[model samples]
Target: MTVYAVVNTKGGVGKTTIAVHLATMLARAGQALLIDGDPQGSAASWAAWRRDGEFSPSPTTTVLLGKAVFNEGKALSQGFDNVVVDAGGRDNGGLRSALLLAQRAVIPVGASNLDAAAMTDLLTVVELAKDYNPDLDVRVLLNRVDPRTKDTAEMLEWLAEQNLAVMDARVCERVAFRRAIGEGATVQEINKKDQAAVSEIEALFKEITQ
Candidate 1:
């Protein structure tokens, strides 16, 4: 019913992790598939780990890069109720391809000066792709936020001036994410006790789909 593309031109922004978590949640709610568009293959590796760990009802996944992502991502979307495409950490064919067809495009930005500054360069690319995917709903996700400061207020205000929507849901940096994804698991899967991390991911999923 929907295609979500998680993209950012800069690396270390938790792009793959966010995509995988959203895919897992979407699969639980409906028939879902994850398309790993990054050459790094991190999302694909996480899918493998989830399988190895014997997780039930995981999203079906595949790797499609370059122009194939545009050509095949749409073709693959037909068989699933939802599709989540994890684009690479650069402005490339794969990223552009996903933008061409995604219903919602999420750009995850880490809460740091450098990551915040990179938003303009990435949004420029998004603007270029907008001619092709005019209906794409773009949202900037505030990821790895520091609980103390929430430190992204200034950056978000800037994005608002550009008329971009910053998602109300934000994900704080936590060890649970690293540990869970390392084992190909979600925070809820690894520890039902870690409600914060679990809630954050769930909220993100709902926000993207809503």
Candidate 2:
């Protein structure tokens, strides 16, 4: 019963995108549940779109904000192989509950100084969650990276200073991500094949799941 959560204190970091994609992939492999722990309800919205579109092998997605993410989410995990929670973009009870419930939490960091700077507050919250869930496996994932720029290297340096281990699979900025996510699909399900996006996301899925 492995539970994963994509969390970040700041908005626009692509937490829902990652969470939904991961949940989709996990559902393809086996029974999986996607909990929308955010009040924004982006994950729930994505699940609804997927339903209308009738995407094959879709995960069961439900909105479970606040402490329901901990209480109800745990109760709902029965018979599921995996659970992925999309934690909201703030210091909220939902986010903290996700931290408590998740066996692994992936924090997506964007490619900018401000994005890296925001980690201080988010990690502070994770630290507090660690007080209770001491075994939580926290991972820092680099998202929206520009392969053409020096930003990736700079962000690596900043992350090194923070002494946090970074995920090897980095998701570069690509139109495929926005297009697929907007349509309640992943790059793998899109009409046009973005091999790069597919590879990046698949690698991430493997890293966290394996």
Which residue pairs show collisions in model 1?
A: 1-81
Return the lDDT, model 1, position 185.
86
**RMSD of each candidate relative to the true structure:** 1.3, 1.0
Query: Which candidate comes out best when scored by lDDT?
Result: 2
Q: Model 2: per-residue lDDT, tens digit, 1-210?
A: 999989999999999989999999999999999999888788999988888887879999999979999999999998799999999975389999999999999999997989988888888999999999999999999999988999889999988888777999999989999999778898999899799999999999999998
lDDT of each: 0.88, 0.91
Alpha-carbon runs more than 4 Å astray in model 1: none
Give stretches of model 2 more than 4 Å off. Answer: none
Which residue pairs come into collision in candidate 2?
none
Candidate 2 structure, TM-score to reference:
0.97
**lDDT per residue, candidate 1, 1-210, as tens digits?**
889999998998989989989899888988999999999899999999999998767999999999888898888889999999999965389998989879899999977768767777788889998987789899999988887874687768777788989999999998899998988888889955478998999898877787
